[model samples]
Target: MKYLYYSLALFILSSFITPNDDADYEKEIKEWHKNRIESLKKENGWLNLAGLFWLEEGRNSFGADIENKIIFPTGKSGNFLGEFILSNGEVFIEAKKGAEIYHENEKVEKLKIFPSEKPILLKHHTLRWFVIKRGNKYAIRLRDLDSPFLKEFHGIETFQIDKKWKLKAKFEPTVGKKIAILDVTGQTSQQDSPGKLIFTVAGKEYALDALAEGDELFIIFGDITNKKETYGAGRFVYAAKPDADGFTSLDFNKAYNPPCAFTPYATCPLPPKQNLLPIAISAGEKNYGNH
Candidate 1:
C-alpha cells in the first residue's frame, strides 16, 4: 500500500509489489497489522483449518466418524458424508445417499474436484472443503466455521513497532542463482532467486538471499531470536523488487510468522541457509500459540 521511488524510473505497483518511504512507519505498520488480522479471519484463513486429510490413490471415504478414510471433526457432518475417488491424479466426489450438499449453490450427487473444470466449493452446514495439491499427492483441506482456534482468537504478539528496524537495502541480482527450500512437511522445493539484499545493521554488514515471488521479493530468514523469542522455524518478509539501480527497502517491522507458526496443517517453507542472519532482528510478529 506504499512505494519507495528510486532514481530509476519504474511504475510503482501495489503493496504486494512495492515498498515505501520511511516517513510513515507508524501509519504503515498499523494498516499492515490490521489487514493481517482481517485476512486471518477470512473464510479461507488458517484459523479455520480443522482437517487436512491426504487422499490415498483409490476410493477414500469421508465422514464425521473416525472410521472413514477422511475423518472430519465429529458432528460436523453426517457419519457417512461422502467418498472421494482419487484415480490417476484425478479426484471425483460422490455424495452419500440423501446427503444435503451443495457445490456452487446447486445440489449435487457427484462432482469432479481435482482438475476441477470450475472452482469447486463444497459445503455442508458450516464445513467447507477443497482439494489441495502438494507435489504429486492430493489432500482435502477442511475448514470449520466453528473452529475453537478462531473462536478463541485474539491477536498476534509482536516485537515493539520501531522505525529503526526498517532500513533500505541494496538488491544485487545474481541472475541464475536458486536455493533448495524445505517446508514444515519435510517436502523440498526450489524457488527462483533474483538476488541478495545487502544492508547494514548496528554498524555490521548483513546480506540475505531473496526469492522472486510474483511481483514482490520474498525473504525467509532466521535470527538469533529464533532460538528463543521468535518462532523456531523462522519468519517471512517481503519487499518490492529492485529498480534499474538495484535498490529496495527491507522493513523488518513487517516481518511476520509463517503459516506453520499457526497450524500444523500448513506447509510453510523454512528459510534457506544463506538467509539466516547472525544478529537478532527484534521487530515484527512474535511467537503465537503452541503449534
Candidate 2:
C-alpha cells in the first residue's frame, strides 16, 4: 500500500512539470532571423546595389552626364568622373583629373580592375563599384552606401515559428549529376549536384535536388506559397551535409528570399523545375516590398 501511494505521488508531480523545449526552439529561430537581418544590412549585402552596367570591348565613359556610356546618379559625381577601358579582355579604370577615386583608402589615378582572385573595389565618396564576370560577360556592379533601399528597409516578414516545419530527411546520393540552373540574366549554367533530399510532409513524400556548396547543401526551392506570400522565383535554404547514416534535417523555418527579391541588380539563380513542390509551405521569409 505504501509503494502504490509513492507511485501516485510521483505521477502527480510529473504532470505539473512543463518542458521548455518548444520555448527554447522558438528563441533559437528568432536569433537566427536576427542574424540574417544583420547580414543583409552589411556593406556587401544586396541592399546597397544600385546599378549593373555591361562593359563594352572599348572605352566606356562613366559619369553623371547623360551622354556617358555608364551613367551614374546625378550630383553624386562630376559630369565626367572616369573611363573604363576594356582591351583584349582586360579591364582598366582611369579616373578623371578632378575625380578622387580611392582603392583600399589609397588614392588611385589608374588601376587594373580584372585578373585577380577577388573583385577589386573602388570607392568615390559614398559610391562603391567592382567588376563582376558572369559566363562570358563582364559588367560593372555599382553600390551606393546611402541607398534608399538600405535606409528604408524595416525587416523581413516570416511565418509563425512552428516546429512542424522542421523535418527529418534522407540523402540519396547521385554523385556525378549536374543540374542546369537558370539565372535572372537568362543564362543557364550547369552546377554540381551532390544528391537529393527526400522528406515527408503531411504524410506525403517529396524530393529536392541538392547542390554542393562547400560543407553544406544549397537548396533553391519553390512551392505553392510563391504565388502568394513568397518570392516568385523561389527561396534559398542551406542544410547540413548528411552524416555517415545519410540523414539530415530540412528546417523550412530558415528559408529566405534570394538576392533578386531584394534588388533588381542582382542576378539570382532560379529553382530547377524538379524542385518546385505542389504543396503549400507556409514557412520562412515572405516576399519583401513590391519586388
Candidate 3:
C-alpha cells in the first residue's frame, strides 16, 4: 500500500510537466541573431573596414595624393600625411609635422610601429590604422568609425529558423591533416584540420572539414545556394567539439556570412573543395547589399 501510494503521487506530478518547444527554440534563434547584429556594429567590427594598403620594403608614403605609395581617401588626410619605413621586416612611422596624426592619443613625430610587438594604432581624423602581418607581407589596415557602410547597415537577412535544419553529426578524426585555404587576396594558406564532421540532410549524407578554433570547430562551406542567395565566396560556421562518443550537431541556423561579405578589405578564406555541398542549404544569412 505504501509503494502504491508513492507511485500514484509520482504519476500525478508528471502529468503537470509541459514544454513549449517551438516557441522556446524560435526565441533562442531570435536572440542569437540579435547578438550577431550587435557584434557587427561594435567598434572593432568589419563594417568599419576602409582600406588595405600593402607596405613595400622601402619607405611607403601615405596621403590623399595620387602619387602616394599608400593613398588615403580624398579629403580624409593631408597630401603629405606620413611615411611608413619598412626595413628588415620591421616597420616604423614618421608622421609629417602639422599633419595632426596621433598615436594612442599623443601626437607622433617618429615611432617604431611595433609589428613584432603589439601593433601601434595611429589615428588621423576619423580614421584609425594599424600594421598587420600576413605571412611574409605587411600592410596597413585602416578603419573609419564614420564609414558609410556602418552608417547604412540596418541588419542582415536570414532564412526562417527551423528545427529540421539542426542535424546530428559524427566526427571522424584525421590525424595530421592540413587543408589548403585560399583567401580573397589570392593567397593560399594551409590550415590544420583536426577532423571532418559527417552529417545527413534530406536523407543524403555529407561531410565538412573542421578546423580547430579555440574550443569550437570552424567550418568554411559552400552550397548550391551560393551566388543566388548567399555570398559567392562562401559562408562560415562553428560547431561544438564532439563528445566522448564522437557525436555533435550542425545547426545550419547559426551559419553566417564571412567578414568578406561586409568589406572587400577582409581576406576571408574560401571554402575548400571538399566542403562544397551539392545541395541547396536554405538557411542562415543571405548576401548583403551589393556585396
| Best-matching candidate per TM-score | 2
| True-vs-predicted CA distance for residue 226, candidate 3, Å | 0.0
Candidate 2 lDDT by residue in tens digits, 1-291: 999999999887766543366777889999999999999999999899989999999999998899999999886777888899988778999998979889998887899989677879999888899998788888999999999889999999999998899999999999799999999999999999999999999999999999999899999999998958999999999999999999999999999999998888998999999999999889999999886
Q: Report clashes for each candidate as comma-separated counts.
A: 1, 0, 0
lDDT ranking, high to low? 2, 3, 1
Itemize residue pairs with steric clashes in candidate 2.
Answer: none
Which candidate has the highest lDDT of all? 2
Looking at model 2, report the run of 10 residues with the lowest lDDT sum: 13-22
If the candidates were sorted by their TM-score against the true structure, best first, what order would they fall in? Answer: 2, 3, 1
- TM-scores for all predictions: 0.89, 0.93, 0.91
Candidate 1, residues 1-291, lDDT tens digits: the string is 234455223554434244454436677898999899889888988888888889999999988788888888887888997899999999899998877888878876988988866657799999999898877878888889888878988999888888888888999888988789987767887677889999999998999999988899999999999958889989999999987888899999999988877777787889888888999999999988863
Which stretches of model 2 miss by more than 4 angstroms?
1-18
lDDT (tens digit, per residue) of candidate 3 on 1-291: 999999998787665542356667778988998999999988788999999999999999999999999999887778989899999988999988899999878999998885545667899998999988877888999999889889999899998888888889999999899999988888888899999999998788999999999999999999999989998888988899999999998998888999988988987889999999999888889889776
**In model 3, how large is the Cα lDDT of residue 196?**
99
